[model samples]
Target: MLGNLIRYLDSVVARDPAPRSRWEVLLYPGVWALFWHRIAHRLFNARLFFLARAVNHLSRFLTAIDIHPGATIGKNFFIDHGFTVIGETAHIGDNVTIYQCVTLGGSNPTNGVGGKRHPTLEDNVIVGSGAQIIGPVTVGKRARIGASAVVTEDVPEGATMIGVKARSTLVKAETYAKEFMPYGTPCKEPCEPVGSQRVDELEEQVAVLREQVAALVEANEQLARKAEKPGKPACKGV
Candidate 1:
């Protein structure tokens, strides 16, 4: 138990930037919630349903993060901010990081009295703020969910999911695991500076414009050739 506590504190210190000391981690809502969740989950597995529910409710009230006692969460789970919701049947693997307002929720509430209503997040998964992963979808290992993405289906391993419908932008999570991404979104490769990206876009636009101009010039030359033919005459302006 002490080892687990130390590991939890260590994970927080290693992953997050704010905590200066181990004592400061005690003040973190995520830490507190996870701490309580460990006890609550144990009680839940022991068939102490009411006690587990009560503990979970208390944790939610204190942290503003709701994790169902029945949900199976693996070690080194980091919830960056509060207001993150994990449903009853949700299963989360090790080294999962979930940001604020992220929901691992069920799509069909009416058919809730069944198995695996909520989604499963595999190891090393990162879910950004305001992202909704609904239904019984399995988010593959090392997958990164972008902010405000709505995912309904299974995500492939090492894929970066973005946009409203959660479009997959292929990025190996192993490449950027050590690098701290603020909103959990991976930048495009050949990662240019803001000014450089703008310049590149302008350059592309200029190239396209040059091609259009050349095509127009060729069309004008063709018309000139037709007009200069022996039997053909140029049309008079209206």
Candidate 2:
């Protein structure tokens, strides 16, 4: 238990720049929430459902972070701010970091009583503020969810998800892990200019238009040649 506490503190300190000392980290709301959650999870695994729920309720009241006791969480998990929600069927992997207002929830809340409904975040995942990962999708390892992104489908490993209905952009996780962005925004790469794909699409359209124009010019020339030929005269208005 002491070892786990030390590891948790170490992880928080390593990831966050604000918490300077272990004492300060111990007082952090996120740390306290995780501490109680560990106890609640143990009771839940032991089939003491009522006690687990009670413990989780208390933790939520204190920390403002609602994590269902039935959810499975791996080590080195860090929540940057409060008001985060983890559903009962949600599974979080190791080295995961989540910011404020993040929700790992179900798409169909009323249905799937016995089945998995929430998302499963794999190792080294980072969820930005107000990001919602819904349904039974598995966000792959080392993936980063950008702020306010709504993810409904599975995210590939080492991918960065951004925007509503989340578009994925690939980035090497090893390089990303070296520096942490406050809102899970990755450093811009040279190859990825903003709206570059749209520009390429527009260029393709222009090329097609040019080709059509050239074809029309050739056809007009052929008609003019036929009209100028001997015994073939241009038609007069009727």
What's the alpha carbon RMSD for model 2? 13.4
lDDT of 1 by residue, 1-238 (tens): 8998888887766666555577888898888888899889999999999999999999999999999998999999899867999998999999888888999998775854687799999998989889999999999998999999999999998888999899988777777666545444343322346448879999999999999999999999999999988974577673
lDDT of each: 0.86, 0.86
Q: What is the C-alpha RMSD of each candidate to the true structure, in Å?
A: 11.1, 13.4
Off by over 4 Å in 1: 109-113, 175-238
> How many collisions per candidate?
0, 0
**Cα error of candidate 2 at position 229, Å:** 84
TM-score between candidate 1 and the true structure: 0.72
Clash count, candidate 2: 0
lDDT per residue (tens digit) for residues 8-52 in model 2: 887777677665567888888787888899999999999999999
Residue pairs with clashing backbones, model 1: none
lDDT of 1 at 155: 96
At residue 115, give the lDDT of candidate 1: 73
